[model samples]
Target: MSASLYLVAMIVIPAIGAAAVAALPRERGLLAKQVTLGVSLVVLLLAVLATAAFDVDGDRFQLTTSVSWIPDFGAEFALGVDGIALVMLLLIGVLVPLVVTASWHEADAGPRPTRVFFAWLLLLEAMMVGVFVATDVLLFYVFFEAMLVPMYFLIGSFGGPRRQYAAVKFFLYSLVGGLIMLAAVIGLYVVSTSQLGEGTFAFDALRQLDIDPEVQKLLFLGFFVAFAIKAPLVPFHTWLPDSGAEAPIGGAVLLVGVLDKVGTFGFLRYCLPLFPDASRFFAPFVLVLAVVGILYAALLAMGQTDMKRLVSYTSISHFGFIALGIFAFTTEAGTGAVLYMVNHGLATGLLFIVVGMLIGRGGSRQIGDYGGVAAKAPLLAGAFLVAGLASLALPGTNSFVSEFLVLIGSFPERPVFTIVATVGIILAALYILLMYQRTMHGPPRGVLLQQDPAEPLSGTGTGTGTGTGTGGATAASATATATRPAAPGTLRVLDLSRRELAVVAPLIALIIGLGVYPQPLLDLIEPAVSATISDLGGTDR
Candidate 1:
């Protein structure tokens, strides 16, 4: 196959894999899982090859493949990747397999067909890859909206007790955003038709149109609102906590890690280059939202009882940082924003997976239910600590490098906003550290006091028991469990199984490795970011 087909293969392999997995015998769930994982690894290898073939100094978009589709609309099945898209592809490649590994037995938790769950995962992977790779606005929009379907099923069919509610909210929010974007997409095409005597949805062609400043603002708002809802900044973020808390762990990882990035990616890819004047005009307002989201979400995270909900809030806060970097109008901040996209995926994905493991052992998602988890499960505790530290952007974690770059780069252009945003780092420390202390550092409490809790526990759903009972005997038993020592046969929390260790090992390596040396990723990201800044005629004061 031609090298240009690499992106095509990346998308096709997973799609075909999904179909195959879905075709497996009902009893062949194990085979279905193995097949899905194998397919994902193959996609990862292709992503690596695509990355290796990408010349840093080459054309702005690489591995491009185009074919005409809707002639009347001037749309084509065009796909390509810039440094930003390539890195996202790499992130998608890395996370999907780990999710598969982490959620190895997630399907068996319900009477839902195991093959169907894995199939949705593979299908979702394909759509996510398409969203990043598409060079045509129409094609990108299709992938963008199409993504909701598989994820809807993944969450609604295979997720926790509140899955249906979460799924509907996620679908509705995304659908509304997509519909608004559709109007903007149509308007953009109309603008192109008037200027060029024909319509085109090609991203490169559209970006060059000399749209009126007033018109740009209108178009900008449509796109910005869509992305904001997707990124889920502040008020638009209400749906995420529910979705994250209710979805399966694998679904939660992708929901926050990759799906949410599309919103920020849209800001960088569409809002900036295509609407430069409007971008500058609206920068201050966008920054206001960004900083507000950071502080607000951080405050909310500190108050969460469900571990998944807390992690989701942290992502909304991190996205605020990404938005700040993008609107800062510096190559450094843009690069940092793009890098943060990848690093956030690594750190947050690992955090979700590890938290899922904790829920698995304890049979509960409530933070108060877990105490001194470190004592009972040292390896699990160690992993959670590492993930928490990374989420807080600790000095030697991957998040630190990206977060540092975003702050310093944005400071000069928007010092007030930058300073306000900086306070979020302190808030992040409070939330992350407090979460760690409450869950892992105290004496065993809640479900950790149950005998053989891990045996039938599936961390993907609602926990088995509520430790908070009004009964005197129950309260006394709980008090006794917390005060007294754990007996050899009582309240046993399992350490990280070898399979779980294998799952998180790569993410831990990347978190530490990239923390130490982010230059390689920066090198790959800088050129495209620079080109984007150049399109806007450099930083706006």
Candidate 2:
């Protein structure tokens, strides 16, 4: 297939699948999931093919398809992929199947299995593809802003107790940011019309039209604010923890996995290339904010008691690294940032899926409620540990390579900021270990733990009087004894089933693979990033 057709297929196939799934009878939910997975796998294969077809030695943008949607206003249906966009597309392709697997059990949770859940998920897959593929700034903006709809519904309709509130907050923050960017989009269109003799929203054409430095800065802020909100950087990131915590695991995965990257992607795709002087002028300030966010979010993560919120905070911290790398403007850092975006999607998406499993088994997200789960559910705990290590950027994990490259790339230009950001790495270890200790280590204390009758014994006995002196021992002992158990001290609860394993195993494999061999991803990203830098008058050769 032509690359353009591949791009269209990425959006269309999932959409059609969503509609088909929605129309299926509730009893055929299994068929719906299978169809969703099949479609997602096909999309992933197409993305892989697109990657293979991408010419790293050639010009910046490749395999483009453009057609005028509205000739009068200079809007068009445009699609293309640079290395950065290609990486994000690959991330989406990988993540959606995992999300479908993660949510498969949810179909049986409510009174009636809502095929609408799968439909929204598939629809979201299409929108995310559009966001990454669209080359026209206005088209990008439309896709960028339109993404909130399916996501909002997914969260609100299928989410937890405060789903409505979290969903509304998410929508409002995104809407406001998009509105600000809309003004900038309008401004760019007008400027292009007046100066270039015709209005155009094509990214290449817009890149050629220079605006006043002051106007450029304003436009940059307009775009930056939208991206930051989407990236959910530091102060703009408050909505994430709540939304992530409230949304179902599938929703949380996509929110952090594919959606958040749009912000960082915007900076690289639009902010740097379109407003080069402003990017340079704003670099130091943005760098400082990025470092501050890294440390701030890490510190917040260290104090989180809710498992979901902790993961959310780590995402903010991870984005801080992506921002720092992008604003640093070095080829290595930029490439690392792009890779970091992909790594975060994989690792963090796995983390959320695993956490959801824990919540599914334990009936609570409170860190203090779980203990000795590792003994009972070794497979699940192992998956969680790998994901956590990836989050902390441990050696031999995917995040470690990207984060190391980011720091090394930024150090020469922004040593102090890089130093501050490095502390976040240390804090990451602390919070992740702390979270693991709380949820997987000591003893099971919550209602879900009590429900497990055959709960195994690991380091210590399952009795309350083991005197480990941990936070949850007493509560877990009491809860465990209270629940129905086949034996006196053992509780039988479900562990990671084959389906759960199917969802997370690929992520773990990729984390290890990418950690070991990131060169291919880096090589592809470097040429396009160099081209971007050359466009900004930074450097390419």
Candidate 3:
């Protein structure tokens, strides 16, 4: 397909699916779920096709097609993907289907659940793809803000008891950031108009304007604040843990895996290129915050009792590394940073899935709530461990390669910052291993052993089981028949179900595949990194 056709399909297909799902009768739960899942699969296939057709050595913006989206305002419905956007779109395509699958039961939960929930999920996917592909800054911002709606409802309506609180916090923080960015967007337009005798929100047109350095810094901050909040770099990061902890598994997956990347992505796509002088002026401040985030968030991850919150904190720490890689301004570090975005989504999304499984089976997010799960649910424990190791960037996992490249690359340009960020790695190992041991090791909890637990918990849907932690063994092995009265009230909890397996299996493969042989991904990333750093006049120190 042509680039315009390809880009249009990527955005429109899911939107059509969402509307279709929404129009279905409220009682058609299973059908609604199926339709949404099918749409996501189709999107995934489209992504594969796009990848196959991509020109490895081509213009920065390939498959680009533009038409005026807003002629009066000079904005266009222009869409394209460079190497950076291409990978992000692929990541979005991969995650949405798994998200629909993983949260199938969540979609089925409550009265009238599937129709609205699935629709929102698909809509979220549509907006996410739009953000990555839009070449018009105004168009990018519009999609950027629209992304919050579905997420807000997902968290508020479907999340934990405190879902409303989490949803509101997330919305308000993002709204404030968006408003700040709106000012910057206007400033850029004003600059474009003054120079060219007409206003335009087209990215290319705006880039040609020569705004005063002071004005550039002001506009840059407007955009940077928005991206940083989305990145959740430290003080700005508090909203993330609450949102991640409260949202349904699918929502949490997208929240961290895709939406948040917009922050760092903004840095790469907009900030660096649009305002070079401003970027240089702010580099040290951003660098300091990135380092602070690494240590501060890791320490908090060490202390979190809620499993999802811990994962969120760890992401904050990881974002720190991503920010460091961008600012370090070496080709290797920048490439590693972009690669880290993809790897973090896979590894951390895996962590969330495994943790969701544990919460489904064990009934609580607390670390001390369970033990001896390794013996009962080896597959579950193993999956959790692999994800944890990946979070810590263990060798032989996808994240390790990216993290190594970032650190090694940064050392030449920023030795001290690199040294401090390295400490985050050690801290990462501590938090992840400790979380694993506490949740997966020791004896199975009483809660884990149910007499006849009705059905497996799906997503955050309410389910009942008395007592806490499901660590205790059933005493009898599966091979032998029940010789005696099977202990008072204990039935074996199953290991990774087919649905859960379906979610993690693909991710597990990618985690290992990319970690072992990352050259293919790096090839796509290096050229873009070089171009960005070249703009900054930066090279290996």
Q: Highest lDDT: give the candidate number.
A: 1
TM-score, model 1 to reference:
0.94
* Ordered list by lDDT, greatest first: 1, 3, 2
lDDT of each: 0.87, 0.83, 0.83
Give the per-residue lDDT of model 1 (tens digit) for 1-541. 6779989999999999999999999999899989999999999999998999999999999899999999988999999999999999999999999999887776666547779989999999999999999999999999999999999998898776688999999999999999999999999999999999999999999989999999999999999889999997878999999999888889999999999999999998999999999999999999999999999999999998889899999999999999999999998889999999999999999999988777755556788777877888888888898899999999999999999999989988889999999999999999999989998886666653442433322455354343211111233343343344445435567788778889888999999999999998898899999989988886632
Off by over 4 Å in 1: 448-457, 463-490
- Can you give the lDDT of residue 489 in candidate 2? 28
Better of 2 and 3 by TM-score: 3
Q: To one decimal, what is the Cα RMSD in angstroms of model 3 from the true structure?
A: 5.0
How high a TM-score does candidate 3 get? 0.93
Answer with 1 or 2, whichever has the higher lDDT: 1
Better of 1 and 3 by TM-score: 1
Candidate 3: tens digits of C-alpha lDDT, residues 300-401: 999987788899999999999999999988889999999999999999999998887777665556776567778877898889988999999999999999
The CA lDDT at 327 in model 1 is 94
1 or 3: which has the higher lDDT? 1
